[model samples]
Target: MTPRARLGRLLNDALHRVMAEDDSVFVLGGDVADPQGGTFKITAGLAKAYPSRVFGTPVGGAAVLGVANGLALTGEKAIVEIPSGGSVAQSFDQILTMSSRLVSMYGRTLPIHLVVRCLVGSGQGDGAAHGRSPQRHFLGVPDLHLFELSPVHDPGEQLAAAIGLGRPSVFFEPRSLYGRYPLTPRAEPGVEVTGPFGGSRWMRLVVGAGAGGPSGVAAEVTVFCTGGTVARSVRAARALAATGVTVQLFVPSRLFPFDLEPVTGFVGPGSLVSVVDDGPGPAGWAGAVAAALATRLWGTLRKAPVLLASAASVVPAARELEDRVVISSTDIVRRLVRELETP
Candidate 1:
């Protein structure tokens, strides 16, 4: 099946699971009840399936989140899907103060399973607000879990895995990738799917052992990337391989609580590293990984790795402009060659 179809099926299964497991698990969003399905069609059939539990909330994001928080505290599970990044901005305060803070403050122990599914990245002319990677905003929040999903060929697996987690997760689906990539047969039902809120996964070295000269010949360069940027990094790796530069591309499936064990092991003394992100430079996961590497693994590195992120600016509305701001495969290939050639 197509990737979008797989994603839709996955989401549908997740919704059904949530409903069957907990009567309190309700869906609240801005015009998510019908037709448009909150822009991305993630919640397309939810309202029809559970009419009483599904609600079309007012445009006020803060109120919607606040209400969800209240319900969660009272032993309810809420899936709040915002229309776009722009709409979610209105709920920041509620997200930070109420939903995030409750777990630590009162030990409320309430599982506020927030599945914030929004379209991010470019190519839809969604404008600055709609086409933003706002996942950076919730990075530092103590009690919340942030996750960004870039399902290249399996939406059903992605959605099932994302929603199966019974905690607050910031699920960011790339707008540009929707309905584009196809789903592989690898995406099947009944597979265990992890929640995005849990933590980031380690980067597995994809390079073949013999291909890297000798078995023990460690990689001198490490490339860290996430989301669509991971695909770009893969392309860059292929290009670098053609030029006789053997580089390792580490793709983190999760964005928060940056997993260091696998990454640190791959990076050693004098290793050249670079991070590629699709969002603004400063607040993206790249910065977080860089800081961690500096503090925890600096002694092992030869030089400070460079961070290749989107230019510090709002996402552009036009397709061409958006493409420029966002990282592409060509951009990755270019950056890798330049960095390796310079020093």
Candidate 2:
């Protein structure tokens, strides 16, 4: 049986493994090595084992990020953890202006091995101040490899994959599912997921026994999603199947350097494609995917691709209120059902 572990533990172990495997690898963050182990306890033990490497910095996210990039440029690998979603916004200058611009400055780089980890997403009832889902913001920055650890995906594997990029990389771990791992296998993930990333541009998966696999019919809708919403998205996809809206999930863990080839082939014009995300609706990640799909599959799609996302307004404080504001599994069902039933 596969061992069950919380995503937090998996990430912690992944970091430790990296640091151990490579002498140059280390961690940098605000109060990361303290007794509390940062906000989520994802860096709990490194401070004790590798005190020389695990750095606990002041509350300034930008300063530490700048320092991290500097170290990476000097042949040292650094894992800088952003304390909050808001903090990433604070450190954008260092992220975009420096870290992301390194390779492009000369059209090449010397392997500035920086693995930045940002914890994002909502639903902790942390209130509006701590309620921003800022994965969309990172997507705007170019030249940085971006990946998110989905709820059903292994944190260690995903983080390790990001670290493998050997360049500047930003990994978003949706806080809502940090400790949300189940003790047993619920079901096989509906898609072939790879990369920090889904390694291949894309691969095909037959969800309904293929066009003749078992159910003997092709999926009616192609669903795309990432991060904490993955498990919920899959559930909604399966639930829709019972109601005759067969669905398939296109989960590219990596966003930037995004390969739209697989998506283009599978989702043609008029094909039901729903891009679901926890990020804001307007000018966000989902919108980016939708726009790209709408263009690639133009003239053939029955209509424009659908974008399902959380409320465009501020994230609510209460869990119940938040659920209403955010896109839930049931919400996917309702949205896709309406679209699928149309015409």
Candidate 3:
């Protein structure tokens, strides 16, 4: 078997490729320089290779993003790294009020290329402050694209795409997935890029769709998940298959500017659609999808769409307590089973 590629290494490689090709691209974040190489080591060796382009900044999110915005304005592509997703709140003004609104404010489209990368979500017992799912808050914001790194896809491909977007964007890296080693071949550097809307995929399937349901249609369960949640949901979907349940699992790369087109086929009148998110319950990205699909599909759905996300509480550091707050594969399986068993 081929050795799996660690996500961190893929990101490091992507940065090297981008910076080498574009002298205008710069990387800024706390402790991103040599030896430190960033808090998570995702920027490892970047400072050494691109000494002038990659530099560490003082520990202030707002100031860091402010610098990035300034660089973007001057035709330079800036990739700003926030140590944790929670810290992005500190720079909300810089991103939402300043960078994102620049083109609209100027009354014309300007080349404001910026990529804000941060470690997001919870699963590790990192406690409240460090473990936060901030992706939900940025959804639907204009001119500011949102993306999350997936263990299933090539991180290098994703990073290159984000940089090439030439728009203000946020790329989320789930803290727990930094070490994930996906056994996949590396994609051709800069060959195929998805930009903001990075497509979706169906991981599992059931033959002939319907099993049995109240609506006389098959009791098909369709699950939509993103980012770190995709891996866990894959497990749950496979477990459901073992139990003789028909399950369809979908993973979307881009969170904002969401496209419902690709996922329409899997859902039907009798389909039980469930969205799994690692963020806050209901109000997160999963909730947005559930609400939109529910409104659009309306009376056609066998049951109302469901959102499976973290509980409405701070993520605890203790493993047992943390499990209650953060969503898991077991939680997904349990929820689907309960819904399927219901009359």
Which candidate leads the pack in lDDT?
3
Give the clash count for each candidate: 7, 11, 1
| TM-score rank order | 3, 2, 1
lDDT of 1 by residue, 142-189 (tens): 756666655432344444445555556676767655454432224422
Q: lDDT of all predictions, in order shown? A: 0.66, 0.73, 0.77
User: Where does model 1 exceed 4 Å of error?
Assistant: 1-9, 152-167, 180-199, 203-217
RMSD for each of the candidates? 4.7, 3.1, 5.3
For 162-259, candidate 2 gives per-residue lDDT tens digits of: 77676788888788777766222244544333222135233233344333332345567877777667777877866876666656666665767677
Candidate 1 has its poorest 10 consecutive residues by lDDT at 189-198
What does candidate 3's lDDT look like per residue over 28-99, in tens digits?
989998899998888889998889999799899999998999999889999998988778899888988988
What is the lDDT for 267 in model 1? 64
Candidate 1 lDDT score relative to the true structure = 0.66
Better of 2 and 3 by lDDT: 3
Which segments of model 3 are wrong by more than 4 Å?
A: 1-3, 183-219
